[model samples]
Target: MPATLPLDLFLGALVTVGLLAYLTYALVRPERF
Candidate 1:
């Protein structure tokens, strides 16, 4: 259970960061999307 907790948190953070990056890129270049 302890090991799974850290893995879950890491995956959540990774996904959040990816979403933020994609949003920022889309905002910067709206023409491409």
Candidate 2:
């Protein structure tokens, strides 16, 4: 169980970054996407 901790944290960070990028893109270009 301890070995999976890093993987979980990495995934969470990845997801958060992805969501932020998507939101930024949508906000910057509402007509393109």
Candidate 3:
């Protein structure tokens, strides 16, 4: 149970980063991604 907490946090962080990166790319290119 304790290990799952860290795992969920890590995955959430990764998703946040990925979403931010995708948004940045979309803003910069507007059509490529």
Candidate 4:
């Protein structure tokens, strides 16, 4: 269980940031096709 801490945090942060970035990009540019 302890060994998974680093991996878990890395993935969690990656997903959270990725989602936020995607949302922001979408809102900033809605004319993209």
* The candidate that achieves the highest TM-score relative to the unseen native structure: 1
Arrange candidates by lDDT, descending: 1, 2, 4, 3
**Candidate 1 residues 1-33, lDDT tens each?**
364567788999999999999999999999999
Residue pairs clashing in model 2 are none
The C-alpha local distance difference test score for the whole of candidate 1 amounts to: 0.92
lDDT of 3 by residue, 2-32 (tens): 6466878899999999999999989999878
lDDT score, candidate 3, position 11: 95
Misplaced by over 4 Å in model 3 are 1-5
lDDT string for model 4 (1-33, tens) is: 465569788999999999999989999999982
Segments of candidate 4 deviating more than 4 angstroms: 1-5
Q: Which 10 successive residues of model 3 have the least lDDT summed?
A: 1-10
Model 4 clashing-pair count: 0
Candidate 4, position 22, lDDT: 92
Per-model TM against the reference: 0.80, 0.77, 0.76, 0.71
Cα lDDT of model 2 by residue, 6-31, tens digit = 87889999999999999999999999
lDDT (Cα, 0-100) at 18 in candidate 3: 100
For model 3, which pairs clash? Answer: none
Clash number for each model: 0, 0, 0, 0
Candidate 2 regions exceeding 4 Å error are 1-5
CA lDDT, every model vs. true structure: 0.92, 0.91, 0.88, 0.88
Q: Residue 8 CA error for candidate 3 (Å)?
A: 0.1
How far off is residue 30 in model 4, in Å? 0.9
